[model samples]
Target: MPRRVTVLEVGLLVVLVGLAGCAGMGTSVESTATSTTDPATTAGATTADTPVSTPGSGYETRTVTLRDENGTRLATVDVWVADTFTKRYVGLSDTSALEPGRGMLFVFDGEDGRSFVMRNMDFPLDMVFVAADGTITTIHHAPVESDGDLTEYTGRAKYVLEVPMGYTNRTGVDVGDRLRVDGA
Candidate 1:
């Protein structure tokens, strides 16, 4: 006995026939369509929605209290101490208010020659790249929102000191100034 053809099967066959007619576009075009339309295939495209790393990351805050030669408290900065990708990459951005005695300190797990740039930043900052021995390698004055203008401190450093603009000069934190990082 022959089976009867159903309307649902006929409709599916017609839809497949129509899709087959439109199939031979190109490998690149097909792959692009699949990737752009499917969430699993287009996972990388959504990475931009992820939050950027910065001082305001949801990491625990570690206080880095500063003192002068006279043992006077010069500044007390609330720093996010984490050797993670998000914290290191995000640095300091979107900070509308930076208290006079506060700053962010990025501690690298290892020592290497590193450089920094200011992009998407709301305000200026003074970058003090410090070596493992608490010696400052280089100091750069990063300008505010100066897109594509990279300020690099070329030196082998394990720590990056980020403070408000003019804070370095105001506190007399010079290139030769020895930085004491958490009793180091």
Candidate 2:
């Protein structure tokens, strides 16, 4: 003779199984939240030489050297390289202040007529446009707009470097000069 389970026993068994399933679900959700919030596990974690995240922006830094037509090195700059579309779109807008000898370099696939604007910039900048052969095509001394009317600076370039205002004048870097990036 076998003993049959009572109606109350079956109901209790169902409740216990449901509670077990919920416990597993809670643990999964908690772990997912923790991983997402942890900086080390995040997507843009910094590496030894490539810092993907800086104070105000997430960009990798590179060393750029500007030279005259005679191959005389004029200046060396630590620049944030904006190679992708997203990085180029954001640019230096998030940066609070660019230290001396520091700037941002935008790289494109090919040389073309490009336009840049000082959108939401806290400080002024000197935009240098470079051709495919590393020759500079144009330099614009852009000032901060107080009237909220942004101006577009257009030039033919495969690379565009933006530095502190008056950087070109101070360094004597003008159009027809050349620029080279280290470990490019």
Top-lDDT candidate index: 2
- TM-score against native, each model: 0.59, 0.68
Candidate 2 per-residue lDDT over residues 1-184, each given as its tens digit: 1123368855864675588577763210000000001111222122355422232346688788888989987777777787765466557665545444567888888887777777546567778889998999998878776536667787888888887676677677899999898997
Clashes of each: 1, 0
lDDT of 2 at 173: 83
After superposition, the stretches of candidate 1 with alpha carbons farther than 4 Å from their true spots are 1-57, 65-76
Error of 1 at 28 (Å): 33
Score candidate 1 by TM-score against the native.
Answer: 0.59
> TM-score winner among the candidates?
2
lDDT of 2 at 159: 84
RMSD of each: 20.2, 20.9
